[model samples]
Structure formats: C-alpha cells, structure tokens
Target: MRTAYSVEMVRAAERELMARLPDGVLMQRAAAGLAAACADVLGRVYGRRVVLLVGSGDNGADALYAGARLARRGAGVTAVLLAPDRTHPEALAALRRAGGRTVPGADAEEPLRRADLVVDGIVGIGGTGGLRPDAAALVDVIGETRAAVVAVDLPSGVEADTGEVHGSAVRADLTVTFGAHKPGLLVDPAREYAGSVRLVDIGLAFPGEAELEALQHADVARLLPVPAAESDKYRRGVVGIAAGSSRYPGAAVLAVAGALRGGAGAVRYVGPAGDAVLARFPETLVSTGTPEQAGRVQAWVVGPGAGDDADAVAAVLGTDVPVLVDADGLRLADRDAVRARRAPTLLTPHAGEAAALLGVAREEVEGARLRAVRELAERYAATVLLKGSTTLVASPGDGPVRVNPTGTGWLATAGSGDVLSGLAGSLLAAGLDALDAGSVGAYLHGLAGRRAADGAPVGAHDVAEAVREAWRDVTD
Candidate 1:
C-alpha cells in the first residue's frame, strides 16, 4: 500500500529529523535527489537548457542547488528568481560559481519559452490559497511552451493537503517529491497537475499511520475473498440485490452480473425485473418481492434503477446485515433510518448524489472530495464511498482513508456504477468491513473497466463481464 501524509504531519517529521541532522544535510539530500530526477528526465544533462523558477523558500533552494549541479555537468542553467533579495544566499553563490546565470522573475519570458526543462519551485507545502498574479503569469508562460516542467516537492499553486487547485497552478510533466507522498499528489485536481510523480526519500520518519492510503495489487490480493475448500454455497455468503424496476430492468441484469463475478456463493435478486434478471443470468435466484421475502442473504445492495422506491430501500436497511445504498436509494433512503441501522451501512454516491445528500452544490463536493467523504461518513455514521475518476472510501473511524487509483474515464458510462454497487455488496456479504469492501470493489471495477475498454468504448455489461478477468489479474 502506498501511503500519503498531510503537510502538518510531514513538517513535524521534517523538523524532528532536521534537528538531529547536521546543518544543510537535509537540503543537500533533497538537492541531490532533485538533480538526479532532472537528469533522468533530460536523458542527457550536457547541453540541456534548464530554467529554474526560483522562489523565496526551500523549494527554490532545492531547484537552485540542483541547477548548480547541472551547470557543473555542462548544462546551461538559468535561475529566474521570483524573489531576488529573498533567494537562498548560499545556493545563489554556488550556482554563480558553477556558471549559472540569474535573472529577475519579470524578465523570465524568453528563457522560459526556449528552455528544454523548466523547474517549478515557486511554492512549497506551506503555501495556501493560490499563486500571486506574477507567479500565475509565469505559470501561463510555462504552459505556452513545450518545456517539460519538473516541480520540486509538488506543483506550485495547488493545496498540498487538500488537492485543491484554486486560480492557477503549474502543470508538471514530472514531480520529484521528497520523503513521502502528500495527500494532494495522490488525489485529483492537484494530482492531474502533478502528472507522473517520483518519490525522493530524504530519510524523514513518520510516526503512526498515514493520513491517506492507496492500495496496490498486493494489498488487493491480500484482501480478496478466497473461498475455503469446505465452503458451500451458503458458507461462502449470498448477496441479495434489491434493484431494477419495470422501467429500467437492465440495472438488475448488470448488478446481478457483477454479483455473480464477486466471489459470492450465490446472488439473490429481489425486484420487479425478475424476467430481465433471469434472461441475463439464469443462475440468479430471482424474486419479484421485497428483501425480507428474498430468503437468506448475508448482505443487500439497494438501488440501481429502483426509481423512487424509498420504502423498498428502507426495508433492506432494516436488516442487520451489511447494506450498500446507491443511485435512487441514495436519494430516497431516510437518513434517520440509515443512521439507526445496527449493521454496517455503505453509501456510494457520485458527486451529484452526494451534493443532494449534503445539501451542497455538486461542485463543492467534487472540489473537496476528501472532506466530503469524511464528513459524509461521520454524518451518517456509515462508510462513505465517493465515486469518481479517483474513487475514495472513508469510514467513521481513525484509520487511513483508501484512495483507489485504478479508475479510467470510460467508467463514466451508464450502468457502470450499478456494477460497482453489486461487487461491493458481494464483498460486504463475504464479511469484509465497509471500507475494505468499497475499496476492493472499486479497485476491481476500475481494473475491469480498463481491461474491457482497452482504449475503446465499452458498455456497462462489458465491464461487468470483465470482473472475472480483473479478479484473476489481481490474484495472479
């Protein structure tokens, strides 16, 4: 699992470590790493045109020192100091001695336009709000050029803790981050600006758990449900799906399709679309009744195309087993009832649905997804899965929130979410907690979407069918 720390946490660790190390030791380590990453990106350092966007902070010092190293190796390095007087004194002297020229930030246009590589060291983790006007204009200049921008630590003008990009920010081809990952680099908006990230360890140790985590394939493999040799159909766990209606029966088929592939022993589907479910998956135990009459099930997946069936959704939530709510269920389910449930409740809401639940605009929820997920989880006292390009699973607990990175944009298609709901419900029935089930289900669903699309358009049914392949790929 790849873990990310908050800015406050990282700073504390850095301060503690810096106190123990010799003067300038940490900066030297960071500079060396930054220089190496720039060299790798340039392929050949000699004769490379390197321009540094020098700021007033340590980030600029890192860039200046790294620029000096490149200058010594025969690269033409120029430092465009945004704050000339406040620039790192020793770093400037070193760069001058190494034959690197320094220029004012306002006069950076020509050098920026023709540079082979532009280093963004304009802002650090402590930066808040957005970039100043001059910095924003410089960023605009960088954008107009073909230079491959490399940001030190993180992309300038983005919130290091929240992944929020207000006003303008630098878009880097590669970001050479130090020590550990920041929450911003692992999430969207800020993450999109970061492009490809390479972690450069500066030997800062963090205590306790990380603020955020992204599960790798090995972590997914460990959490996957593997049936025991002696396990029977009932023993493996059955997932009851309360979805689909006469108006939209395809949802039932798709949800059942995903459930069938989910490691669950059997899938019990209860809705008005029994014929549609039977037509697609003959193996599914079908019923045109409520969840209570749908026989025994370890978990229930409510809503996919149930329309305004709040009563039916409430019936499933009354059960003691883990329950997952999505689509119409997210809109219609009574909040009080959901909060009153004894069993684990998982709410999967897209930005719009989440906005409806929180009484905020969709943009607000989408902009601060980390805050939205955590607040939703805490508000309803249930696990909240905010589905998007970067899916997030947060529970009402102290553990790290899981951020899934396997998603592709093709998953924005219709019925894709229904497939995800079923798969997550199946995992819940198999006895994984709400957080694990949501995270693993999202992981598989995304991988399957990628596999199914393979750069082409794919239907939701294709994504559902590809779940088996995704499972095999993960476990392999």
Candidate 2:
C-alpha cells in the first residue's frame, strides 16, 4: 500500500528528525537527493544548462544547494531568484563558490530559453491557493521553454493537504518528493500537474496512520476471496442483484455479468429484465417478484438502470443483508431508511450523482472530491465509493480513506458503473467489509478496463469479461 501524510504530520516528523541531526545536515540530505534526480533527468550533468526557480523559502535553499552540486559536476547552472534579498545566504554562497550564477526573476527569460532542465522550488508544502503574480509570470516563461521540469517536494501552488489547485501552478514533468508522500501528490487536480512522482527517503519517521492510503496489487490480492476446498456454493457466498427496467434491461445484464465474474458462488437476479439477463447468462437464478421473495442471499446490489423502481429499491434497503446502492437507486433510495439499516450499506455515485445527493453543483464535488466523499459517508452513516478518474472509498469514521490508483478515461463509457456495483456487492457477500470491498472492487474494475480497452474503445461487457484476467493477474 502507498500512504500519504498531511503537511502538519510531515512537518512534525521533520522537526523531530532535524533536532537529532547536526545543523544543515537534513537540508544537505535533501539537496543530494534532488541533485542526483536532476542528474538522472539530464542524462549528463556536464555542460548541461540547468535553471532553478528559487523562492524565499527552504525549498529555494534546497534548489540553490542542489544547483551547487550540479555546478561542481561541470553543469552551467543559473538560479532565477524570485526573492533575491530573502534568498538563503549560505545556500547562495555555496552556489557561487561552486560556479553557479544567479539571475533575478525579471532576467530569467534568457537563461530559461537556453536551459536543458528547470527545477521548480518556487513553493513548498506550506504553499496554498496559487502562485504569486511575480512567480506566476516565471511559470509562464518556464512553459515556453522546451526544458524537462523537475519539481522539489511537490508542484508549486497546489495545496499539500487538500490537493486543490486554485490558480496558476507549475506543471512539472517529474516531482521529487522527500521523506513521505503528500496528499496532493497522490490525489487529482494537483496530481495531474505532477506528471510523475519519485519519493526520496530522508529518514523522517511518522507515528500514527497516514491521512490517505492507496492499495497496490499485493493488498488487493490479500483481500480477494479464495474458496476453501470443502466449501460448497452456499458456503462460498451468493449475491442478489435487483436491477434493470424495461427501458434499460442492459443494466441488469451488465450487473449480472460482473457478479458472475466476481468470487460469488451464485448470482440471484430479481427485476423486470429477467428474460434479457437469462438470455445473456442462463446460469443466473432469475425472479420477477420483489427482492424479499428472491430466497436467500448474502448480499444485495440495488439500482443500476433501475429507472424509478421505488418499491424495489425500498425492499432491497429493508433487507438484513449488506446492500449496495447505485445509479437510479441512488435517486430512488431513502436516506433515512439507508441510515436506519443495521446491515452495512455501500453507496456508489459519480460526480453528478454525488452532487445531486449533496445538493451541490457537480463542479463542487469534482473540485473537492475528498471533502465531498467524506461528507457523504458521514451524512448517510455508510460507506461511499465516489467513482471517477480516482475512485475513493470512505467509511463513516476518521480512518484513512482508501484511493484506487488504477483506471483509464475509457471507463467513462455507459453501464461501466453497473458492473462495478455488482463486483463490489459480490465482495461484500464474500465477507469483506464495505471499505475493503469498495476499494478492491474498484482496483480490479480499473485494471479490467485498461486491459479491455488497451488504448482502444471498449464496451461495458468487455470490462466485465476482463475481470477474470485482472483477478488472475493479481493472484499470480
């Protein structure tokens, strides 16, 4: 698993570590790592034209010290000092001693135009909102240069704790983060600006849990269900899917398709699209009656092109088994009934659906996904899977929220979420908690989407079909 800590937590850890080390030792360690990474990006330090964007913070000192290292290696380094008077005195002296020259931010264009690489140290973890106007101008100039950009710690102008980018920010080809990952580096908006990330350990120890966690292959593999040798169909688990309407029978077919591929022993589907589902998958136990008459099931998946089937949504929510709500179900299901349930409930919604639930604009949810998802989980007193470029799973607690790292833009296709609903529901039936089920299901679903699309367009059925491959890939 990959973990990210908040700015306050990182600062506390850094301060404790700095107290134990000699003066300037920690900064040297960071500079060394930054210089090494810059060398790698340049391929050869000798005769390279490197430009450093230096600010009035420790990050600027880091850049100056790193530039000194490169200068000693025979690179022609120039520092574009945004705050000449406030720049680190010792760091500037070190750079000058190593033959690195400094140019004011106003005179940066000439050096920037001829640079082979540009290192962004304009802002650090303490920065918020966006870049200052003077700094913003330099970023604009840097954009015109054909240099490969490397940002120190994180891209300038993004919120380290919240991943929000309010205004103009430096977009780097690569970001060299120190000690630990920041929430902004792992989440989107800011994540998009940070093209690629490389972590450099400076030996800062963090005590408590991370603010956010992203599951990798090994973590998902551990969560997946593998039936025991003596386990029968009933012993394994059964997932009940109540979905589809005459208007959208394909939703039911797609949901059942994903459920069949999941680790469930059997899939019992109840909806008006029974005949369509039966045609696609004859093995499914079909019923036209309410979910109450669907016999026994370990978990239930409601919604997914359900139209306005309020009765069906109500009936599924009332069940004692764990239930997942999605699509039309999100609109039809009652919040009080959902909050009133003792059994676990999982709510899956895209940005638009989530906006509707929270009674806000879709842009608001998209802009602040972490806050939105957390608010939804707390309000409903249930787990929420906010589906998008980065799928987030948050339960009704202060625990670290799980972020799914896998996925492609191709997943934006229709009926894709319906498949996810069934897959997660099956995991719930297999006994994984709402958090684990939602994250793992998203992980697999994303990998399957990538495999099925492979740079081309693919249908929802293709993604569902590729889940088996994703499962095997993880297990192996």
Flag clash pairs in model 1: none
Q: Candidate 2: lDDT of 103?
A: 90
lDDT of 1 by residue, 397-417 (tens): 777999998978989999999
lDDT of each structure? 0.93, 0.94
Deviation in Å, model 1, residue 115 alpha carbon: 0.3
Q: After superposition, how far is residue 242 of candidate 2 from its true place, in Å?
A: 0.9
**Number of backbone collisions per candidate:** 0, 0
Error of 2 at 72 (Å): 1.0
- Lowest summed lDDT window (length 10), candidate 1: 285-294
Over 1-476, each residue of candidate 2 has an lDDT whose tens digit, in order, gives: 99999999999999999999999999999999999999999999999999999999989999999999999999999999999999999999999999999999899999999999999999999998789999998889888989999999999988888888888889999999999999888777788988899999999998988989999999999999999999988887999999999999999999999998888899999999999999999999998778999999999999998999999999999999999999999999899999999999999999999999999999889878888899999999999999997788999989998888999999999999999999999999988889998999999999999999999999999999999999999999
